[model samples]
Target: MLAVIRYTVPESQSQDFAKQGQTILDTFAGQPGFLRGRLARSVDEPNLWALVTEWEGAGFYRRALSAARLVMYPLMILMVNEPSAYEDVHAQDGT
Candidate 1:
């Protein structure tokens, strides 16, 4: 499962936002089912940032989030929209 959170940061806050994003990613990296995660900035929209993470499954992702609520709740306030979770429906080889 993939979890994605997007944020619209002001130029003045971009550095601070990136640092916060790195903390979130690092926290997730230490969890049981975290597969991979990244922080990205949109080329055309510099203030647009995203946190993308892959988990073993949706259940693991949900559980991890619940367990980390104390740390995540504050971070959630920075998001421009609700975070989303996606299930992969197909693969490059058509699996």
Candidate 2:
């Protein structure tokens, strides 16, 4: 299994941004390579969140995310909290 961890502080108008961001994330469920996902947000920071994602084997997260980021950056620049990223890793399969 592979995990992708992305964290970021969204801009001031986080509502709309987070909505679309969730749409983008939800799209992964329809993706042929997608496995599962875990979405989390900071209790102290409303705009801060970490999307822990799982994939089947390997994938091209960068390129795919680059496209999503393009849409996300412009509308939600003010909420920039932390770093947004995807990480590669090994995990034990529960199923």
Candidate 3:
């Protein structure tokens, strides 16, 4: 499963945004079923960012968020309101 949280950050706050994203990723790392995660900025729109996380499943992802709400609220509250959870129907690896 995948969880993608998008955010629109001003140019002035990009650095802080990246730092906060890293912190969130770090927090997720300690949770069960956290496969991996990344912090990315859109190439076409520099101010557009995403915190993408891969989890074992939607249940695991939801549990992680619910457990970390206290530590995550500050930045989590800034994410754009949209459907962020997804299931992988098909996946291919370059290798």
Candidate 4:
């Protein structure tokens, strides 16, 4: 499963937002079933940021969110909208 959280930060808070995003990635990195995660900024919109993460499944992702050590929840609340989760519908083999 993939989780994507979008944030629209002001120019003055970009640095702080980036730091908090990295902290989220680090926190989830050690959790069970965590696949990978990345932080990205939109090319056309400087203040638009995205925190993308891949997990073994939706359940894994949900559990990670509830973990005690996951302190990124507060930062996540700053997202412009609710986070999104997606399921892979295509095969890597391209059948």
Candidate 5:
């Protein structure tokens, strides 16, 4: 199944969060079951953003979320692990 994880951070830690998030995405982009990240634009300010990251499958999504919780967002997250699930198939491969 396809998965989407969303979250928000407090306004104050936006910069730090964004920087670390970019690093994490870079680090995990090519991992098995990792798909791609869809970054959201801040509706209010530069500091605010909505992230909609889609993974290749839900198992990968769960494992990644667990690690991200432990390794990332030790302080800045206002919410976490907000994931939605559905059937997903790669467009190019139709698999």
Candidate 6:
């Protein structure tokens, strides 16, 4: 499963955004079933950013969220309001 949380941040806040994202990623690393995560900026839209993470399953993602709620709240509160969970249907084999 994938969880993608997007944010609209001004260029001035880019550094802060990345810093906070790294902290959140570190917190997630301690949770069970966390595969990998990335903090990326959009090439087309400089101010757009995404916190993308792969999980073993939706359940794992949910559990991670519940477990890290306090540590994640600051950054999570900045996320765009929308559905963020997805099931992979066509990922490359062995990836």
Query: What's the TM-score of each model vs. the native?
Result: 0.85, 0.55, 0.92, 0.85, 0.60, 0.89
Q: Which is superior by TM-score, 1 or 3? A: 3
Q: Model 4 over residues 28-62: C-alpha lDDT tens digits?
A: 89789999999999999998999899999999898
- Runs of candidate 4 exceeding 4 Å displacement: 68-70, 91-95
Best by TM-score: 3
List model 5 lDDT by residue over 1-95, tens digit each: 55544456667777777776676676456457777775564676654455556677778877876666644555335544554666654545555
Residues 8-94 of candidate 2 have per-residue lDDT tens digits of 654565566567657767766655667677666778876666566666544545445554665446545444454544455554649
Per-candidate clashes, comma-separated: 0, 7, 0, 0, 0, 0
lDDT for each residue of candidate 1 in 1-95, tens digit (9 for 90 to 100): 88998988889988888888888888888888999999999999998899899999998888877776776676676687775799998746454
State the displacement of the C-alpha of residue 11, model 6, in Å, after optimal TM-score superposition: 1.4
| RMSD to truth, every model | 2.6, 4.2, 1.2, 2.7, 4.4, 1.9
**lDDT against the true structure, each candidate:** 0.84, 0.57, 0.88, 0.84, 0.61, 0.88
Over 4 Å off, model 1: 93-95
Query: Which digits, one per residue and each the tens of the lDDT, describe model 6 over residues 1-95?
Result: 99998988889888988998898888888899999999999999998899899999999999988887877677665678999899998888684
Q: Give the Å error, residue 87, model 2.
A: 7.7
Q: In candidate 2, how many Å is residue 79 off?
A: 9.5
lDDT of 4 at 20: 83
- Collision pairs in model 6: none
lDDT of 3 by residue, 12-33 (tens): 9888888878888898999999
Candidate 1 colliding pairs: none
The predicted structure with the larger TM-score, 1 or 6, is: 6
**Candidate 3: residue pairs that collide:** none
